[model samples]
Target chain A: MEITPAHYTVLSAALFSIGVIGVLVRRNVIIIFMAIELMLNAVNINLVAHARYLENLAGQVFVVFVIAVAAAEAAVGLGILLAFFRNKETVNIDEMNIMRW
Target chain B: MAEAIAFYTLAVLILGLGVAVITTPKTVHSVVFLVLNFLCVAVLYVVLRAEFLAVIQVLVYAGGIVVLYLFVVMLVNLKRAPEAHEDPRRLARLGLALSGAVLLELAGIVVYSYGRVTPASAPAAAGPLTGAGNTEELGWLLYTDYLIPFEVASVLLLVAMVGAIVLARRES
Candidate 1:
């Protein structure tokens, strides 16, 4: 059977759903960040697949930007995580309620 | 044929590792699983003909980002189980239900929208960089059509690097 764009979309969607589940269900802040990365990867897959289907290089260009942004996000986010962990001595989201009213 | 086989295998591995990245008890193990998941996605990018992206995905994601995660995990030395104190009001099940609802909504949207539109039968006429290779075409577009955004991304990275240092440094 030939692989179609829809097949890639379905796979992307499933992977994204797993990421969503991870973010929502996991309490560990670090794991949540990994879930966010998973979601980003899923979107990248969709972008590249459609870029191939449409023969458009712009989608690939956008993927490059996405990677750059994801890198910056991971860096800043992990730095924040380190600072928070130092103060709270925990990585659980439940304990990260400093700003919660 | 081979493409289908490879795609299915990678898809399974990607999804499975994504699950493991969340469900694993140990943070370090989860980081390892995340790296594996990224490598699999890089291979899929190759399958999709985004060779430059595949390289970026491997180098920045599996190589750089996951190592950052590992370092943070090691530095945060958990003296006690972080998840030991469960908040009384924490609604774990509700979170699961909400995620399931989102999944269903996404699936419905995909089925509804995709059924209506027909895919272009042929790859659209070779794009502007018709004669160029993948990386060359990407570079050309980055320098020409996307120069401003590319410059902006570099600036964003620089700012983020500074901010990260400021945030992670110990206060005197």
Candidate 2:
């Protein structure tokens, strides 16, 4: 069987669904962050696949930007996680209700 | 035939590692699984003919972000697992239902789009870059059409670095 763009799309969608499930089901903040990264990777896969199928460079370019943004997000997010853990002493999201009304 | 085999193998590895990263009991183990997932994704990028992206994915994600996660996991030092405290309000069930709905919706969109649109032939304008190689074409576009966004990305990285340091620093 030949690998088509549709195959890539289907794979991307499955990966994305797993990421969504991870974000929703996981309690650990760090694990949730990893799930988010997985979602981003899925998007990158779709972008590059389409770029190849369409013979355009734009998709690859966008993937570059996505990677940069993801790097920044991970840094800031992990920093926040560190600060939160320091204060709360737990990584559970349910316990992070300091501002709850 | 070999390409299909490699693609399927990488896809399964990527998805399986992703699931492990989310569901693993220990955060440290989850971080390790995440590294493997990222590496598989980098390989997928290479298979898709984006060599530059594959390298960047490995360097920045597998190299940089996973380390940050590992450091935080070690520093946090959890006495009890995060999963011990279930909300007990059926929220997990609700989350599952919500995510299932989202997945169905996304699948519908993908199928609809694929059915409606036919793949177009490659445009004639990109002919010059076909011979330029992946990295060179990417670099040309990055420096030319995307110069402003490129500069902005650097600034964003700098700001993220400063912010992370400030947030992680000990209080005086």
DockQ (C-alpha based) per candidate is 0.76, 0.71
**lDDT for residue A71 in candidate 2, whole number 0-100:** 90
User: Pick by TM-score: which candidate is best?
Assistant: 1
Full-model lDDT for every candidate: 0.90, 0.87
**Candidate 1 residue spans exceeding 4 A from truth:** B119-130
State the TM-score, rounded to 2 decimals, of chain A in model 2: 0.96
Per-residue alpha-carbon lDDT of model 1 for B71-118, expressed as tens digits? 999899998887888889898899889888888888888898888777
User: Judged by DockQ cut-offs, is candidate 2 incorrect, acceptable, medium or high?
Assistant: medium
**C-alpha lDDT of residue B148 in model 2:** 98
Model 2 sits at an interface RMSD, in angstroms, of 1.9
Give every collision pair in model 2. Answer: none
| Share of true Cα-Cα contacts across chains kept by each model | 0.78, 0.78
lDDT of candidate 2 over A1-101, digit per residue (tens): 87777778888888898899989888889999989999999999999988887888899999999999999999999999998988988999878778872
Candidate 1 chain B least-lDDT 10 residues: B121-130
Which of the numbered candidates is closest to the native, going by highest lDDT?
A: 1
Segments in model 2 whose C-alpha atoms lie over 4 Å from true places: B119-129
